[model samples]
Each structure stands twice: as C-alpha cells, then as structure tokens.
Target: MHDDHDHHHHDHHGHDHHHDNRYSDMQARVRALETVLSEKGLIDPGAIDAIVEAYETKIGPRNGAHVVAKAWTDPDFADWLKRDATAAIASLGYTGRQGEHMRALFNTPETHNLVVCTLCSCYPWSVLGLPPVWYKAPAYRSRAVIDPRGVLAEFGVTLPEEKKIRVWDSTAELRYLVIPERPEGTEGLAEEELAGLVSRDAMIGSAIAGAAS
Candidate 1:
C-alpha cells in the first residue's frame, strides 16, 4: 500500500521560531560576516555561493539516491546497506561524515520503525539532500515517540497497535534512514519509479516499503 504523504505542506506548529534559529536569519548572519571580511579586503563573497551550489547540487543527494536505488535492486547489497552503511555505500564511490556512522534499519511487514530526534533532528544529509521542514517540527519531536501511529496516520499511514515501535534518538554525529524491503508487485519496476514510493518516513522506518500502483 502506497502511504499517503503531504510533502507539499510545511507544518509550523510548535516551531522553535524565536528568530534565534531561523534558517534565513542564519544565512543572513553568515552573509553579514562575510561582507565585513570583504570590506576589509580579506575575502570574496562570490566564492561562497559557488561552493554552496556545488555541494547542494553536485555532491549531496545524488550519492544517497544512488545508494538507495542500488539497494532496492540487489539482495546482497541490502545486507551491505544494513551491516556497514558507510563502507557498503563507499563501495559505490560515496563516503564521508553524513554517512560516517550510518546505521541502516530494515523494516518489514511484521515490523515497523520510525526515526526522530527528541533532542534535535539528525538526518542523512548525503541522501536526503536536506531535511524536510516537518522533520524538525516541534510537534513531531514531542509526539512521535509517544504516539507513533497517530502521527503517521496524519500522513495516511496506519499500522497495527500490536507492532512495537522503536524511536531512535538522532544526534549530531550519527544515525541514518534506509527504509525496508519493498513489497510485492514491484518486481518489474525500475529504480526511479521505486524511489517515488519511498516516503520520507518509509526510509526512517515509520511505514513499510510500498509497491507503486
């Protein structure tokens, strides 16, 4: 079953919006500091933009997406994905901090899992490109562990209460999401199509891997 997701929306409830943690404000501050250096003839602001663009585009998600695509197609590869995510992923030419301490948790029809950071939102920057806005929501932080199923239902996912839920505390240094085995009926599909069914939480373990219709 393809789990419903509302990626179009960004939940703002319980946001840590004290202007102290705003992304824009953070960007502005960095820009401001750079401008000061430029005025003093110490740096070139032009260089930062190019560097940021390369990382955001040329390096990040492409690596993670490729790993996911490969795992979906190879059974032995999936084992590599779980046992030692970094080396397993590095074998494909992708490596580094975002995946440095990578841990892959495989979900199944009989088991379901979800990832959350009660202290803070830690994510796989290499594959995900960037964390979704809702991934850092205060509502998500407070409620996910206490009411995993209810939160997932909001996104059109409903799991049986009999299944025990495990919520991993994400930290600044470790943890990664790799979703579980894909359901049947997806046997003939290509990697690109299969990727679409991987909801953000599917990889994190909240829902089972869905076969696209």
Candidate 2:
C-alpha cells in the first residue's frame, strides 16, 4: 500500500517552536560566519557551494536508494543485510565515518520503523548524506520515541491502526537505515527504476516508497 502523502496541511501541535527558532538562529549565524570567512579570503564560496551541492545531489539519498533497490531484487543480499547491515552495505561501496556501524530496519505490512537519535543527531551520513535539520531538532528527538504515531502523522504518513510503529534510536556507535516496503505494481521494474521510487524520507521512515505509476 502507498502510505506516504504530502503533508500540505499537517498540524504543528507537536512541534517545539522554541527549538525551531533556535535552529533558524543557528542557520543565520552559520551563513554570517561563511560570509565573513569568504570576505577574509579564508574560505572559497564556490568551493563551499560545490561541497554542499555534491552532498545534496551526488552523495545523498541516492546511495541509500541503490542499497534498498538491490535488497529488493536480491534475496541473498537482503538476507545478508538482515544479518550484518554494516558489511552488506559496505559491500556496495558505501562506507565511512558516521556509518561505521549500521543496522537495517525493514518495514513490513504489520510494522513500520522510524529512526531517531534521542541523545543527539547521530545519523548515517555515508549513505543518507547530511541529515535534515528537523531530524536534529530537539522536538523530533524527544517526540519520535514518546509519540511515534503522532510524529509520523506530522510527516503525512498514516499507517493502518493495526500496524505497529517501531522507533529505533541511533547512536554515535551505531546508526539505522529504514528499508521501506516495496510498493505494489513494481514487480516488473528494474533495480535502477526501483531506486527512483525510494525517497530519502522513506528510508528514514517518515514517508513510504513511491507507488509504481
């Protein structure tokens, strides 16, 4: 089933406005710092933009999507991923810093998985690239565990009432990657095509894989 939707009118009752404001302030400070550094010839604005662009386009969710697609097509790899996610993922050439230790949370018809770092923003940067600002917010960290269903609702993901919501806490030592359920009508699709259906949020459990069209 297609479980994801655009949250055009989601309620923000669960959000901590204070945290949002702080995040905004932090971003502004960062931009100001970047400007000062560039003016002083201490940093190259073009290089900074290039690095950010690489992460956003080349090294981001596409890496995770490839892994998910491979798992969907190869049972042996899927088994290996279930057995040792870190090694299985590394076998695909996706390995490094924040992703040194990894775990794969496979979503199923009866259950959905959501990942969060309660203590801090411990994320799998190797595959998923930089984490989203919301993922690092204090509100998200605290609420994802206390009220996962409500949190998912905020992301426009509404699971069946009978389906269980499982929340995984990521740590500096180990991080998680959600493997969303493969959408229906995709049996004939190739792996590359399948990868296109998986979104960054889907792998994080805030959204579902796109339904085949």
Candidate 3:
C-alpha cells in the first residue's frame, strides 16, 4: 500500500512538471520566432534597444502623442492616417524598422481597441516605443485575446456594457496602433497642448486619455 501511494504521488508531481515544461516551451518558441524574424530583417536588434532607451530617457511616448494629437485636431491628417498609417506617420518623420507596416485603430464612443501579439512581442517601436514588459508575457499574450475585458479591467480601464472591445493581434508583417479617443473640455487646446494629454498606456488601450489635470 505504501509503495502504491508513493507511485501515485510521483505521477502527480510528474504531471505538474510536464505542465511547467509546456510553459517553458512556449517561451522558447517565442524566442525562436524573434530570432527568425531578426534573421529575415523583420526585427532589428538595435531598434529594440534604441526604442527602450528613448522611452526610458528621451523622446518616449511624445512621438505617439504628437501623432494622436494631429489626428484629433486635423481631420485631413486623420483620414490619411486611416488610409495609410505608414505614410502618414512617416510624413511626420516617425518612420523606423519595425514600424514599416502600421494600421491605426481609432476608438470611438461605441468601440475600443486593444492590441496584443499572441505568438511573440511584435510591436511598432517607432511610434509607441518599446512594449511594456507585461505585453510580452505569456499570460498577457493569451489573456489579451481570451479575456480582453478582464485584462482591461486589471489595467483600470472599465468600459461600459454598451461599448464594444476590439482586440488586434500584431505580427511580423504588420502592427497596430490604437488611437485613443480625444478627451473632452479641451476644444480650444493647441495641437502641442493636446499632445500633452496623451499617455503611453492610453495609446496601448490599457487606459483612457482623460482630461489633462
């Protein structure tokens, strides 16, 4: 009886170990994808570091802020962004390696947009800067698509039941940019001033761009 019980316990532990191995395998696959993309010139190693440094020290989310502000204030520019995000964003001199292919997702009173890379961390570094650490985690990669509403809630974004949530998946060939809804009570603000109200999280669809305090 003792030996049988011990064998049962060992099998249970082995099952848990197998589950952990699967998680590690997923991470390994993600790294392998990154390597393959890098070899194919889809991902630039320096570009990642540059983006991280920019966000940590200089430039930062200001690049995206400007884009968002321009879109909010200039209807023509907004149309251009919707039509050809890459060219429109490049027109403002925000072009880079991973940002070669871009699509702008506009949030409205009835719809919200969220972005995630289920396979790997494919992000538009030029405009949004380096993706947050959580964006690359397996939990986020899976949950963002499976339970986006719950994920948004964790980020302190509570959407009304009437509002629809749209989750976009990023890939090596393309990436998404969430154009947050403009805040209220700032109708007379200048473009630069409007830019100040935009935040990185807001652009990520994890938070809303509230009225600038």
Candidate 4:
C-alpha cells in the first residue's frame, strides 16, 4: 500500500468558490422542491412565513425577559427561583415543555456557578432559546468537568482553588443553568431597567453581571 498526500492547494479561493456554488445550487433545489410539493397539494408554502413570524414576533427572549423582571421586583420570588426554578419560573407565568424540570444555580461574589453538560446538550431552553454555539462545542464538554477554571479563564472568569467547584451532572429528566449574581450598581433600578442587564450567558453560568458590554 502506498499513501501520498499533497501539502496544500494553491488557490484557497477555489475551495471558497466551490462552496458558494454548492450553496447556490442547494437554494435553487430547495425552491424548486417547494414549488413541486405545493403544486401536488403536499405542502402549504405560506406556512413557512407564518412559522417565521411566530418565532420572530411571538416567541423567544420573552421568557427570559419576564424572569429577569420578576427577580428585580420581588425578593421572595427571587428566593423561590433559587430554590426551585421549575415552579418559580412557572409562577412568573413562563411555563413550557423546555423548562419543566429546570433547576437554577446561584452565582455569588464568593462562589461562582458555571454550567456545562459534559455528556449532552441539556439546557434550560424555556427561558433561553437556541443555546449559544459554544454551548454545544467539543472543548466545553471535555474540559468543563475536569478543568473548569481553565475554561472559565477564556471567558475572563477565574476562581481560587480554595473555592469549591460544584459540578451538577444533568439528565434529560432535569435541565439547569446558573442565575448570575446581580451587579452592585443595579441597586435602585426598576424591574424593566434590570431586565436589560440579563444575558443568556449570565443565566448559563459562564459569566456574571458587573457592567453591561
């Protein structure tokens, strides 16, 4: 057996052009397929626009925004969110299939909370829609459980060795995300103003609130 590999291609732009052509071909094929299916009465073309509007107008971001507003207004409700996220989040009238068994982790100045499912892509999707791209990456799954501090450093978060790392292994039966410790300056802000500071990463436990960037 003989194995010989070329060092590299001379024109990288050639590969990029090929990819662009494939993408254009795919778009044309998809449009043609839709037309055929609609002509045969197998599909409703208008449904795609309706579905897009539903997500763009009605769903997503609303759930997390509601939760952040509630935490700012009610201390008792905030405590409930820390204790039982599924029930507490529901109390805010944000119940759905994605957050049925969601558990919340609280990040404090002394003890920070970070979440990563080293096994699968388990997350609190009810509040946060599509997980961030990195959330489903290979590096996160492998290093987070073993060297959390190292991974956190990339995101500018570092913890002392004396501080314990609490790793919660998740299951499809139970999903989780961290509730960030609030910032100092947000003290007298109203619920609406406070909601502006909340980010999905803050909820997922990779970061904390200090200043909005």
lDDT value, candidate 4, whole model: 0.69
Candidate 4, residue 62: CA error in Å? 5.5
Q: How many clashes does the backbone of model 3 have?
A: 0
Best by TM-score: 2
lDDT of each: 0.68, 0.87, 0.84, 0.69
Please give me the total number of clashing residue pairs in predicted model 1: 1
User: Per-residue lDDT tens digits of candidate 4, residues 1-213?
Assistant: 112222344475556343222335666677789779889998775776765565566656556756866776788988888888888987866565643587777666567777787778876666777677898998887788888888777877666777765666666778775666677777798887777777766666676554432
Model 4, residue 144: distance off in Å is: 0.9
Q: Write the per-residue lDDT of candidate 3 for residues 115-208, one digit (tens) a residue.
A: 9999899987878878889989999999999999999988888899899999999888888888999998989999999988988888878888
TM-score for predicted model 3 compared with the true structure: 0.73
Please write out the lDDT profile of model 2 over residues 84-172, one tens digit for every residue: 99999999988855536999999999999999999889888878998999999999999999999999888888889999999999889
How many pairs of residues collide in model 4? 0
Sort every candidate by TM-score, greatest first.
2, 3, 1, 4
Tens digits of per-residue lDDT for model 1, 1-213? 112222333347855444333336666676688779889998765676665675677665446556766788887998888888867877977655443577776666566768887887787765555666787899988898898888878766677777666777778777677565676788898888776666555666655556221
| Candidate 4 segments whose C-alpha is farther than 4 A from its true place | 1-62
Task: Report clashes for each candidate as comma-separated counts.
Answer: 1, 0, 0, 0
- RMSD per candidate (Å) reads 10.4, 11.1, 11.5, 8.9
Angstrom error at residue 37, model 4: 13
The segments of candidate 2 whose C-alpha lies over 4 angstroms from its true place after superposition are: 1-57, 211-213
What residue pairs clash in candidate 1, if any at all? 113-205
